[model samples]
Target: MVAERKTHPYLSLMNSYLIDSPQPSSISYWYNLGSLLGLCLVIQICSGLFLAMHYCSDITLAFDSVEHIMRDVNYGWLIRYLHATGASFFFVCIYLHIGKAIYYGSYRKPRTLVWVIGVIILIATMATGFLGYCLVYGQMSHWGATVITNLFSAIPWVGNDIVQFIWGGFSVSNPTIHRFFAFHFVLPFILAALVVLHFLALHTHGSSNPLGITGNIDRIAFHPYFSFKDLITVFFLVLIICLFVFFSPNTLGHPNNYIPGNPMVTPASIVPEWYFLPFYAILRSIPNKLGGVVGMFSALLILLFLPLLDRSLYRGLAFKPLSKFFFWLFVFNFILLGNIGHLHVEVPFINLGIYCTIAYFSYFLIIVPTISTLENILFYLGRSNK
Candidate 1:
């Protein structure tokens, strides 16, 4: 039975995935965010597939079917809430993952493509999340879509055409709901593909650890060491998710969505899902509809160019004194934008939105480039690199 050839060791290269490499440093909790993102993707997909079994994409019966699953199917509520809450958790993980990248300089040099893929994932997730919100066919979902799609009209020349074509008609209706659901169901797979691209880039450059030292060969393998660490975080994550599913399933949800879609009634406030509040604020900051939309999309588009924005010789947060301050300030500004996004788009809120939107872009356009320049000057002056 043993007919193995002497030159056949490389034939089982796939087996190497399970073995640990010695390239990674002693990573901590921050390292878990990327793997946790992968876990969330799986949870979201499974929960969604189950819910899809009972979901009726038809606008007329969509709300009724969701109600039926709640009232009739055994433990359907648990599954539905898990899927819903998984979404919020998913974005939180990505935010932390993105921050981890920034803090440790994972976006520099060889890992820039990884960062690029992450941004693409971020945008795609937002697009699908927006569509997913509309799939519920509730009053809030309807009006939320109305407010969001109207933003496309900000495009100047062909904005109106883009908006109408996307909706499959002049307004949000059955066609809109159906298309949203189809896209919602489809986007996560595309996200998974991007994730594959991301990991390939990560593997090619090797993972950037806390020290932000990527070129060192004296590190640990990803198989046993990193995978074991990630598995521990996965358990804790599930515990948190289960708490939301079993206890406060409705906590993150708007009460208005409980009611079925009603054209005669409009919700007092048109807010998006909580995860999208920051960009939602950016969108509403402008007085003009098309302008608001452009601002929102452009804000994200700017992130794709970050490798050029920052030109510092050093990458980690600890060494760059000036860059460190601006980084934290920008983080706070982002959080503030999210808080303001939940408020009514009036007076003080609009004013705050305008400032935050400007500040938001400035962090990339000005603060980042300025700090990087300051670092280079300091470096040339022999200020400090140690």
Candidate 2:
């Protein structure tokens, strides 16, 4: 039960954010993804703190430390599995959250700050995940770190210097692992702060609804209404996470990572985690070293321009049939990029990756503005004829 209003500052703030805040009455299950994401952030931070307690960041002992946690420490395996599985699920929830925002035009106008902070959070989370992955110091972890850090060398003048700065040396070594562990440990706290900012920005204008209309006319308290509804999705999320943690712990991981790091031998195929597949595919699609690097970063940075690019008179895609259709097609193209990223960069796969990269950028650059403008004209024309 929500407590009665009081003079205490903490209680008053809680009332503002949780108990008394108004939410759209018509908002559906998609809105629940935000709460799910918050839960995921908490799970990751707690488990990672515990894992770090016994983890040794030295390259020689890093792999062994992970084994010690799994085989020697008490319930360490559960914590480790939870952290790993939670990383994947975090991306799942965030991707859906971004998709919901786009579908409802939540990034437009007053809510642009919220959406921009979210994209920054996405970038931070990617960095944190990459750092954590390297802390394992297994075969895949070591080589993956080497490969990804080397991407910085594609720059024109100071690229090699930047790579060296990141490695703390000429290559991935003892100092590199040590630095990664430190950054991996620190970034989550920054991520948590960013999440708080995201909430503040969102609450400034309240939540968006399905019909693309103002939510003020029909609103409900967040506490007992949608808070309980959020629990429904949380239950399903926990069920799925548990299934992965206990039944199929390594299903999302590479087998090569099980072996200890070896500088002399390289995995025949080195790929980032599955969550990174689409962008990784974009990176590989370009033939030139520098071009691929620019293309990959552009793919992410382009999302920030959505608010300006969408020229429609209204928010949300519910009334825009053409925009809705193209949105789903864009989703398909993204999935295709991820699929291509999993294959070897040769023959048909290279060609396929190139085509998908083009489609991916075209959806934002050309399709969105054109479709939005066309829909605006049709809306007025139909009204006049009626």
Model 2 shows how many backbone clashes?
0
What does candidate 1's lDDT look like per residue over 1-386, in tens digits?
A: 12242234753343344443444665678978988999899988998998889999888999998898888989898888888899989999999888878888888887899899999999998887788888888898888888788777767799889889888898887788888889999999999999989877776767776765554856766666777888899999999988888888888888999988897898888778888888889987887776777788898888888888888877777677787888898899999999998898778888988999899999899988888888888888885545
| Segments of candidate 2 deviating more than 4 angstroms | 1-6
| Cα lDDT for residue 198, candidate 2 | 98
TM-score of 1: 0.93
Error of 1 at 77 (Å): 1.0
lDDT of 2 by residue, 1-386 (tens): 34555456778788888877999999999999999999999999999999999999988899999999999999999999999999999999998999999999999988999999999999999999999988988898899999999999999899999999998998899999999999999999999999999999999999999999999999999988988999999999999999999999999988888999898998888888888999999999999989999999999999999999999999999888899999999999998998898788899999999999999999999999999989999999999999
Output the worst ten-in-a-row residue range by lDDT, candidate 2.
1-10
Give the clashing pairs for model 2.
Answer: none
- What's the count of clashing pairs in each model shown? 11, 0
